[model samples]
Target: MAECNDLFLKFNDEIKLGSEKKKSLRKSRNAVGKDIQKYFDETLKVTKPKFWGQGSYMMNTIINPIEGEYDLDSGVYLMHLSDVEEEDWPATSTVHNWIKNAVKNRTSTPPQDKNTCIRVIYKDDYHVDLPIYIKNKDMEHPKLAHKSKGWIDSDPKELTKWFTDEVKEKSDQLKRIVRYFKAWKDFKANGDKFPSGMIFTILTANHYVEGYEENDDSAFVAVAKEIYDTLDENFSLDRPVFPKEELLEGWSETAKNNFLSKLSTLITNGQKALEEENKEEASKIWIKVFGDRLPKYTPPKEENRMDKGYALQTTEPPVLGNYGRSS
Candidate 1:
């Protein structure tokens, strides 16, 4: 019988980011976080700016980073931007520029002003994304700035809470399964055609109910199949935690198709790996799906054989200290 559960436990450990690396990344993130807060405290002169984390890092759904770098999303809320005093407050560009200028030299390279956030790259180590939001006193929702799309309502805290709650309910195995999906996505995507990390999280969370099989491999296989079987071209990922947030709204058809195609292939190969009796054979199938990140199987170290030894057999519990043929 295949000890697939045991093998998967070993594989999970191999892909997990080490405690030392995580500690270092957290330290870097904290330094920049303080800088962002300090900048607003000195200059903004409006309602105080609030800073918090979002995305994978905050949600505790982080997988091993794609390249060598971890991407962190830190959110800063300008609560006064809610007021519609057109003349006094500048557009998002000013806010973005202020943040960019503040963190310019902090990053290894110059900071990038992306569509919705300012990105500070730390080269081979990690990158921090600063997404600025406006929380209006008049309204219940927070609006994110997008150069192209204008202010869009989103609730990062709610989204994070939802994922965190599910992971707790299902145990950390839910997170491991999510990481497995993302790892496969990272290893497999040859170009920019893959779905966003949020989509993967939402989709995985959608199909992830309780009662997972005891084995990690079987649980993952079941989750993958559930997603594959239930997915449709018209599928929309609604943020179950956030009120009316659609995470999958703007996904390109090409990207969706690409994701589905890859998903089907993974399900097929995962099924084969599960059916395999030989671990080496099973690992080969998994390697084809997961690529080089997955650890290859090596037979455990065998005990040294006794010279002229006989294979031990037990019809019943053998009497210890009695090596001669039993009467």
Candidate 2:
């Protein structure tokens, strides 16, 4: 069997958000936060909002997209004023409009007022999602301002904590496994109609296999097979925290079937790559699953191979450095 650990590590490096992009994303996030803060302080003159970094960005499982723009999710929290009663919090649409109006002109494109959050687009091909919420002392959890669904109990902080805690308990490889699955989704689905990053994160965390920390190829195959078998048996996933609601309950039949079919293909190709002996051939199989961003396999020099007895020795496991936030 071919040891493709080096190739997997290289793929991870290529797909992850680099330092420059992270810096740019941070600057964008900070600017948006300030823009929102200014609106509330100078215009709304209501309760000031608190900002919390959430989603894949905070959990550090986000990958650089293959085709579309990047995303950053920030939670905007509005504390209930002392004079206001718990039952008298602003309407969901009102709060969403407040956010929308706040960042209206921050970008050349007007802020998009969506059902769940307000989206601010930038010229750099990335956007920030500000999910508004109301926090009252009497309420157990913050309520999200959904345009259609109205105010609903939701807390992104809980979800972030859940993922970070799982990473702490499990191996850090779980994070990479999630990113690999996300990259597959981005490359194959090619749009937002597929399973979300949160869904992928939940599935990978639940099905991640231990003891393959040194071999990401084996680790990914094991996790993919586990998820495939489980979803095949019962097509459902629940949020690990908060509402604890079904994550895939809203997926259309076509979307679910398409995901399953693609996942099945990934498993077959992944197993084939593992069985292939030629390093370059194995990498080609991987390219079919991921895109051409994966590094091409290079042949060892004849002199170095002879001096190092490479023909008789086994392939070395790739040394993977820490790729994301340690937490």
The number of the candidate with the highest lDDT is 2
Q: How many clashes show up per model?
A: 0, 0
Residue 122 lDDT in candidate 2: 92
Off by over 4 Å in 1: 44-48, 66-68, 79-89, 243-245, 250-254, 301-327
> CA lDDT of each candidate?
0.73, 0.84
lDDT of each residue in 1-327, candidate 2, tens digit only: 677787889889888888899999989989998888888888977667888999999998899987678999999988535345657776888888888998998899999999999999998889999998877666677778899989887989998899999999997888889999998887888653767899999999999877677889888988899999999888999999997788889877777788888899998898888777777888899988988887778776434234455555545445343221111
Model 2 misplacement above 4 A: 80-83, 191-193, 304-327
TM-score of each: 0.84, 0.90
Clashing pairs in 1: none
RMSD list, candidates in order: 7.4, 5.1
